[model samples]
Target: MVAVTDKSILGCRYGSSQPQRDTVLYADLYREGRLLLDELVTETYPVEDFAKAADDAHHGRVARGVLVF
Candidate 1:
């Protein structure tokens, strides 16, 4: 993987700069790096478990967690 540059950090990543506070962008699902995981997903949790997921994320136990109905 390549290191992110200042320009990339400003452009590709959002909400990092104070000047961008007023800029609004509408992104398409696919265009926003959204992907279809389908059955490839490994874990899921109920919405009530969000606190547990938040703790896991804070502790670096997982990269991400999903809450579902």
Candidate 2:
């Protein structure tokens, strides 16, 4: 495993049944879905071109890159 030297880098469990494991704000969730429907959140990428998606993400070209089946 690669250890990040940046102190600003933090890690946390995103979703867990454990109490206080992660609390997703309702407004944030609603906004995410709403933005997606409005084509403001992200764009879908073809599954076959996954490498391109990765490259775009590495270059900070996307908010969220989804591979469509």
Candidate 3:
């Protein structure tokens, strides 16, 4: 199961009951330079090119993208 709780800002998958713990663990990993989130962003585009970004994402051309304003 997967869930996201706004109050705790927790997101979990695979039936994890300890979402809070997972959040902390991930935070620690990021701080330790183990989680490379920037590498996941394969593309970035200005908000003006939102349509292009969306298209690329839909076409599987973009693995992950950030739309900047």
In terms of lDDT, the best-performing candidate is: 3
- Model 3: per-residue Cα lDDT over 1-69, one tens digit each: 978676555666767558778889888999999998888899999999999999999999989999998
Query: Backbone collision count in every prediction?
Result: 0, 0, 0
Clash number for candidate 3 = 0
Candidate 2 — which residues are off by over 4 angstroms?
Answer: 1-40
lDDT of 1 at 42: 42
**Per-residue accuracy of model 1 over 1-69 as CA lDDT, tens digit each:** 988676543354444544443333323443565644444444577999989878887887766577897
Candidates sorted by TM-score, best first: 3, 2, 1
Which residue ranges in model 1 land beyond 4 Å of their true spot? 1-42
| Tens digit of per-residue lDDT, candidate 2, span 29-68 | 6667742344654778889999999999899999888888
Please identify which of the two predictions, 1 or 2, would achieve the higher TM-score against the true structure.
2
TM-score of 1: 0.40
* CA lDDT for candidate 1: 0.61
